[model samples]
Target: MYKKSLVFLFLVFTVCHGDIFEECEDVESESFVSSWQSCQSYVYCDGDESMLGECDEGQYFDPETSSCDDAANVKCFLDEVDEPSVEEEPEPEPTPPVMEQPTDVEIVNTAPVVKPNCPNSDDPSQVIFMANNASCADYYLCYHGHAIEMHCTNQLHFNGLTGQCDYPENVHCPLDEPSAHKCLPHITDFFPHPDKCSYFYYCIKGFLTLQQCPFYYGWDIERRSCVQLNVAKCYGNSRRA
Candidate 1:
């Protein structure tokens, strides 16, 4: 009788911890759960909108009107928008504002006249004459109704009907003439005598004319240094005899 009792206890313990309890048992072919637990281990649900035509769960299988919005984690069902049978509203026309005429001011008509004041004689109070040996013969006639100073140094070819020197062709200066010209502006009262004009530079010294101080190594007045002019290498260097 004791042996029978021991066999009964062993059989009961084995039955309690059976292999069938530990194994996963599928509730349906599509979903499954552990046989040992009441709650399902995994559940297969229909796809939402994003994965159209796909069989994967949480993805949209229907493409017709559904869109899977993972951000909202919901399937967006769009309604088919039928074409409207009625005409749409016409856009409003913009209105132009009425402007009022201004009062009290009379617009005066004036003619544009080009007065060829002698070249370099801009101030009305001052009297200026053409340099005795001015390279251009006719003096500077305002071309294009604007005054620009040009010189004729070489020959008749250098002097055009405009009374201005033509820029030399096929020649290049070490530094450009424009940049050099910018260094000096308004050479007022620069009255070097005809004989000295070729060889000397005149500077206006507080309304009195004075010769440019010889600058062998440095700029005068400013005490800034510069190199001696190589007359042979550079044209326009002073032919100071």
Candidate 2:
């Protein structure tokens, strides 16, 4: 009996801390856990509609939903700090509240908008939620009307001018070291593919792999991360290396 208890503890530790994760049909899978994510995780927020997805190289999270239209889109903005270019986002349509919520998590709309701001300049008055912010790495929300400063996974910062998090070339951040983003959500494992937006990733047993839908197809959230959505008519030859 004591030996069985030890094995159970080990399994719990691995599931909670191990980097392994597999794709599932829904949040009901045995692997489902709140806030779980993989080693390389990225996310986008559409007015509380925060979901994990990939972004283009060098580009930071932009509130411009158009910029984040699909996984395959690319972006790379370079600008200075202090001169923020956070654009105002239009009011989004009312949708169901987010599935995951902590007791202390502050509501964006209810929170006062008077940000000093997140690593990336959010709507100067509102919180701009990104999967990866340079400071307040995780579980940070409005601190007295000011969006909490986000930190890079390990080494990064939000450039006010470019409106993204990246290396410190001209941006007003440390110029010596660099960092990467890590999994923050309870459900940490799979996310959109970083390089090939058409693809998403699956992490299991400390291993990660990129996955994509069948030919000329795209990911349909209502369906499967990998499915034949047949949106190729809108985008010719939707295949990329």
Candidate 3:
């Protein structure tokens, strides 16, 4: 009888001190728990096992999001140890330098110019198609006197004569010019182009590429995708007259 009581107590103690694996049993699969020891480290549970994981450098495991996030956004109280206050000495002030003569230097503008509006056609109601002079793979679709930039994928170029995207060998358009636009290093998602509402930048794993929306569509910054011109509110212009 006494031996049976000891066995029951042992089982209770083991179940009470089962550590992270016991805590993970109640959580759903593929969930995370912030580590009490360090803010950067967390425990990822896959229903079968619990594994320790660490966030990237300068990042902290966010308990709210269940993912590693920027340190500025995370409030980590686990690793909040009282830091020792250090006394600092005041530094001496520096002397001012003499002014130098200014030289005349030619300043050139390297900013990308805004795309031209759709050309005026004989009938404003009729849709017009025109080839982009700067790119062979891109063209403009004029809808109701509005310029809608479009591009051809799979190395195809826009054929002005055929009014369609065709093989480069079949088209006689000018050589494509390199784009002056560049993506920001910190931004790794789809973002709208500063100069063009129809164009957006796709950045992933440090590789950057420019993309365009379809006709009567504009890049929506909030939605991170192309939406209708009426819904996008790009430059406060509507799709219809």
Candidate 4:
């Protein structure tokens, strides 16, 4: 029985070796032997479960697909890794022109110059002195609140003695009586006279003397003087009448 069992075991082993060689023979290359199973020595699951089959040189087997795809190929794509390109913005345009502002120094305020009341006073535009008795015809003009001196060109007669520039009222003498030719003594009229101006000049009824008188007095024609209160002479002539 020992001898018969030994012979049967040897025959079974030889048949198994022959089957493995025939099955793996279809894999032509000598390097294809690795595709065969070690224990049974047969084609591994018909190339599907082979240990080494159709494997990439540098890649390992991928169990999910049962293939040898690249390790780097599984990573994100180049397009995904790179960020999207940003658009460039356009520049703004310039604004229109504007007018310049005016300066404060350009504007000026001025007061009108005062004028004389007389129609044809030496200078019609020249201003005259102001007094309490100033009339519309002989309106008084002021300069810095003070009365200004004026020529007697507007008066018909002048009283030298009393320094009045208006006509005398109800004189005792006749109109034809020639009066003394005289001028007023007021410092504002006589002392400070113009160097070349005519102090006396002929007028309508008598002569006009460049002089001044106080508001209360009038000219005394017969005496050639100004009278205070229209009655008495306030100033005397150089020559006694």
Candidate 5:
């Protein structure tokens, strides 16, 4: 009975080994052995029950083909190295234009000179004076806010007396030209002069002569002589009639 029991145990172990690992004998090289068991050396499951098997070395289980392969061949990730990661590249923005500064010194411009008023007073435009007096011939013109004197041509002198331009010869004694010029004493008209008692000009023959009345006397034009203004005469004139 003991001898029979030993035989039985040997047969059981042999059968379990055979059932767990398929014989790698006909597998010509290490490649076939690894492929057959996926490099599992100790544990292997064939159908249902697990048993022991052997692999050459340095290899792991490959689930896909259900076999053992080389360390280089077995992979949990087969396409890991083969598949490249796809990444998006961003587009570059457009560059702005550059402005260049001038190196040379910039020239600053000066404002132009301007004249303040009208070009000339001689223009056809007429202007009046302080007295509201205006005439093309005798008037006042303004140049830069100043009055420019104007006059009429040839033989015409402004008659301040009559407010007209008359001959100088025509404008005679007792000059009615106006105020300070009025009541002019002349060679022809013997009039009383406030300055001397009297003073006069007389045209004798072709010669002109100056004559003065006595200190206390004045010239009387109607009498044509120097007479006493009061009751006195400084002297008697033979020329006086």
Candidate 6:
């Protein structure tokens, strides 16, 4: 009875493990064969002798490639019997908030200024100085009929009357004037008097000198000098006294 029981146990073990090597006998050359029991296990055949082999973790024996391959690429129904449980992935941490920058600083123009051309004039030797229309601290000097752009240092404005850069308080730029009636001290240009047709104000050396035109002539604001009475238009009073 003891011998019979041992023989039965041996038969059971052979049925379970030995069945995998049944196909290996048909393979004449040294090769691998897929096991019927488990996809992870295979049969290595060498002539008439055979042995069981296992693939690496997460791999399966592939009969087509005749080698162990990734389980995802191998098609094995037996792998479903001991499938690994799916694990849940953890949620990502929340992102931090961004901080804003302050906006209290003053914004100033830093671009290079495009130099302007000198005003049209008949007298080339006048050496005229004109204030910049865009910036009070900048001016242009007309030398030999060409304009030389210049900047005033120490935050001073170009004084047309003084023919030099001076403090902003003492300089009256022509841009600040609402009308042409006010004489600009920073320029040597002549301006017509508001109340007199024959009289005009000439800016020279930072001073306004009132001068009268010759007989039968009136101060022409457009001409910037005296002209015949018929061509000159006076804002106030008769064209001729």
TM-score of each: 0.18, 0.22, 0.24, 0.14, 0.17, 0.26
Please write out the lDDT profile of model 2 over residues 1-241, one tens digit for every residue. 0112212222223212322233222333322222222212233222223344432333232333322222223232322213223343555643433344446755444433222333543343455433323222222344333333344443344454444455545554321122221334433455444434356566565565667654334543222244433321112223332
- How are the candidates ranked when ordered by lDDT, highest leading? 6, 3, 5, 2, 4, 1
Model 4: what TM-score?
A: 0.14
lDDT of 1: 0.27
- Alpha carbon lDDT of residue 54, candidate 5? 37
Query: Would you list the clashing residue pairs of candidate 6?
Result: 160-186, 161-185, 161-186, 161-206
Residue 134 C-alpha lDDT in model 4: 22
Which should have the higher lDDT, number 1 or number 2?
Answer: 2
Question: For model 5, what is the alpha-carbon lDDT of residue 73?
Answer: 66
Pairs that collide in candidate 3 are none
lDDT of each: 0.27, 0.35, 0.56, 0.31, 0.38, 0.58
Predictions: Cα RMSD each: 38.2, 22.4, 21.3, 59.5, 65.2, 43.1
Clashing pairs in model 1, backbone N/Cα/C closer than 3 A = 48-59, 48-60, 49-60, 49-68, 50-68, 51-60
Q: Write the residue-wise lDDT of candidate 5 on 71-101 in tens digits.
A: 5666534324232233325456434334345
Superposition error at 201 for model 4 (Å): 28
lDDT of 6 by residue, 1-241 (tens): 0112222222222223343466676686667677754676676666435566666656677787666667888887664554334342555633333333546644533322232455565242245565566555667765444555677876566776666778766986553343754555566766667666878878775688889886456775433556665566554454344
What is model 1's C-alpha RMSD? 38.2
In candidate 5, what residue range of length 10 has the lowest lDDT sum?
1-10
The digit string of per-residue lDDT tens for model 1 on 1-241 reads 0112222222212122222322223233322221111111112222221110112223221222222222233322321223223332555643433433557645434322223354532333332333212232223333222344333444221323222334445223222243332214444423322332222234443344434323222121111112232221122332322
Over the full model, what C-alpha lDDT does candidate 5 score relative to the true structure?
A: 0.38
Task: Assess candidate 2 and give its lDDT.
Answer: 0.35
Indicate whether candidate 1 or candidate 6 has the larger lDDT: 6
Tell how far residue 84 is off in model 4, in angstroms: 99
Off by over 4 Å in 2: 1-187, 191-196, 214-241
